[model samples]
Target chain A: MLIGACLFAAGLYMVLTKSNAIQVLIGIEFIINAGVINLVAFGKYDRYHNSGQIFALFAIVLAAAATAVALAIILNVYRRFKTIDPGKIDELKD
Target chain B: MEQGIFIFLGLTTVASAWFVAASQNLVRSVFMFFVTLFAVAGLYVFALADFVAVTQIVIYVGGVLVLMLFTFMLSSKETLEKLEESRHPVFTLKQFPALLVAAAFLIVLVNAIFKLKPDQLGWILQATNNTFRPQDNTVTNIGTNLMTTFLLPFEAISILLMMALIGAAHLARKERSFD
Candidate 1:
């Protein structure tokens, strides 16, 4: 759990500070991994149901799927804006 | 011996994760994140989640990392160079707030975890009384549970995966003009 907390913090820092969208995605992956660790750790006690393991499996799959979609969106954004910096892409706000 | 291995893996994971957070080069950071993932998988083994550990390797290291690398390669090299040049330093006025937030979150989570007591949990006591026999392998158990108790979720996940893949393919395809 301490490990997960540290990972989560690192990831949160990454997400908040990184300007590049892909790096932000990396941060998001870090956060998901932290959650998975906590889930698996707690699930160790549930010998009969194994609910934690099941939930972790689903979380991993969802993370992958979300990453794929996010990458695709980032790719399109790059094509249109010619830059991947989240701060630079402010046409939507303007 | 087991405790030593756990400590070793935990150190590896945390160290690499910090490296990932601090590395200047995007490619190097990606590689470091790879190390972090592998170490976490080892930690999962210590937690008796063997199946999840293997799945973490296959999905994260094999699938996700490979996809990230592929995307990096596909992007224009000049843009990547610009991104590297414009990268933020580890400690900066702009990043100070983010650092504070992350540190605060970590402290809170660690304090909560430290306060938690597994021995006081009723479910854990019941499980112990029921004689929780640790399985040598959990693959069979997971498979049975997926088929029986988790059938709906299992099926839903398959569909979700399929739809996500199709959507990704569609989204990534080259744009066409229709006049």
Candidate 2:
């Protein structure tokens, strides 16, 4: 549990401070992992139902899909702006 | 014995996560993310969620990490150069506030978890039941439950994954040059 806490904090810090889009995506992955750890840990007590493990499985699959789409979007952004830095790619802002 | 393994895995997860967040090179950070994910999977195994652990390895290690690596390597040379140039070797003022926020969040959450008895958390009823009637073979039970109770969600996930696949392909298609 403490491990999950540490990972969540570190991931959050990375997301907040990193200017690079890919780094932010990596940090998002970290946060998802922290949640996965917690879900599995809590599921330990409910061995009969395996709800936690099932949920973790669902989360993993979804996370994989999300990562693929985000990477694609990031790649598209790079193609257009010639940069992947979120700080630099602000054309959407007025 | 089990507790010792759990502690070791937990420590590994924390250390790798720290490296993932603090490393200077983006490549190294992604690699550290691999270690962090692997350690978290090990923790899942210790938590008696062996199937989830294996799924973590298959999906995270096999699928996501490889995709990240591909993206990293195949990104435009200019973008790569820019990434290398902006890499930070150590903490800077930009990160100080984020670190503070993370630390505060950790303290508040850990304190809350300690204060509230596990039983008091309404959703954690199964956790507090305490007898640990472990489903010795989780696969059969999980299969049965998915088929019976979670049938809808299980099917929905397949549709979601298909949509994601199509969407990503569409997003990444090569653009035509208008002459």
Candidate 3:
């Protein structure tokens, strides 16, 4: 649990500090892994159902799918804007 | 021995995660993220989630990290050069606000963790007393449950994955406007 919390904090920091969109995705992955750790830790006690592990598996797949879509979007954004920096991609704002 | 290994794995996970967050080089940060993921898989093993650990390696390490690397490579070279040239020290005054927010969140979560005491929950206590025999083979139970109780979700996730695949390919293809 403590480990999960620490990872969450680190991920949040990563998300906030990094300007790169892909780095932000990496941060999001860290946050998801943190949640998975907590779930698996609690699932250890639930020996029969073991739903936590199952949920973690689902979460992993979802995260992977999300990453795929997100990276694709990032690639498209780079092609259009010529930059992957989240701060610089402000064509939508103006 | 088990406790020691658990502690070691936990440290490995957190430290590598910290490196992933702190590293300035994008490529180096991604590699550190890989270490963090593997350490997390080790932590999953300590939790007796062998299946999850395997899935973590196969999906996260094999699929996602490789995809991230490919995207990194495919990004505009000028952007990579700009990012590489704009390096700052690990700790800077500009990042103080982010550090503060992350620390505040950690403090709140740690307080909640100690206060909640999940181990003392009624369901956990009952489950531990009645059918809590630790078994070596969780894969069989997982497969049975997936086929029986979780069949709907299993099918739904497959459909979701397929949609994501098609969507990604469509979104990532060279724009017709550019041709």
Candidate 4:
């Protein structure tokens, strides 16, 4: 749907444009949301199995778990760098 | 008509999402994320996914949004000035190419949507009708399918979520060093 597409674009722009680690994660959430919208819309047509709705549910849960893990990683990054900006923390080395 | 509510939800969802993408302050961005998600939940209800809509609110709005709020508060000293000071600019050298590509993608998708309306073998298929004609009990049907046909995936996802929780704990824990 156009709504989903618009969201995907906005999210992609954020992920690309923002140097903040948390902001990037927000963008990733947006991308997941767009997918969920499309899946649920398709589910409307599925009278028998509702596969789209099931997949959308799975996607939402998985997205939450992913955000938790990503936040943990970001916290660790902040610990090492004392900053949340992804651009400043280029190297893996502490 | 339902169109009125649908239009409102769509507008609010898109506008709040845009704010999330553009807001400068980290805290404001997180708050806007909550509004955007809540609007999306409303849209889910309109889509007739009652169970999914409820889960969206409970897990996404209630659970994830709270977690993000805590992260924002704990990571930074909260002040109104801090909110405005931490705002990042919308574009820089690293993001220019990305903006271009995403804009192009949006234009293409919109063009396709306009070109391929439902009757013209649309680019993507969608079902606008109520799926459960005989029975409107979506929750019951989903529960049955989860325990039966999709049992493996349902169980697997539970395991995956558990692992993710453990992994987050391990990663966030402080390191013990031998001095």
lDDT of candidate 4 at residue B111, scale 0 to 100? 94
lDDT of 1 by residue, A1-94 (tens): 8899999999999999887888899999999999999899888887767788888999999999998888888887787788888998988622
Q: What are the per-residue Cα lDDT tens digits for candidate 3 across B1-179?
A: 98998898889889988988898889899988888898899988888888999999999999999999999898868778889899989989989999999999999999999998977878777775533344668899888888887889889999999999999999999978853
How many residue pairs clash in each candidate at the backbone level? 0, 0, 0, 1
Q: Which candidate, 1 or 3, has the higher TM-score?
A: 3
Window of ten residues with lowest summed lDDT in model 4 chain B: B118-127
* Model 3 spans with C-alpha error above 4 angstroms: B129-134
Off by over 4 Å in 4: B78-83, B86-95, B118-130, B133-135
Cα-based RMSD of the predictions, in order? Answer: 2.1, 2.4, 1.6, 3.0
TM-score of chain A of each: 0.96, 0.95, 0.95, 0.96
Best candidate (score: DockQ): 3
- What is the iRMS for every candidate structure? 1.8, 1.9, 1.3, 2.5
Between prediction 2 and prediction 4, the one with superior TM-score is: 2
Better of 1 and 2 by TM-score: 1
| Per-residue lDDT of B139 in model 1 | 82
**TM agreement with the true structure for every prediction:** 0.94, 0.92, 0.95, 0.89
Docking class of 1: medium
Which candidate number has the best lDDT? Answer: 3
DockQ order, best first, reads 3, 2, 1, 4
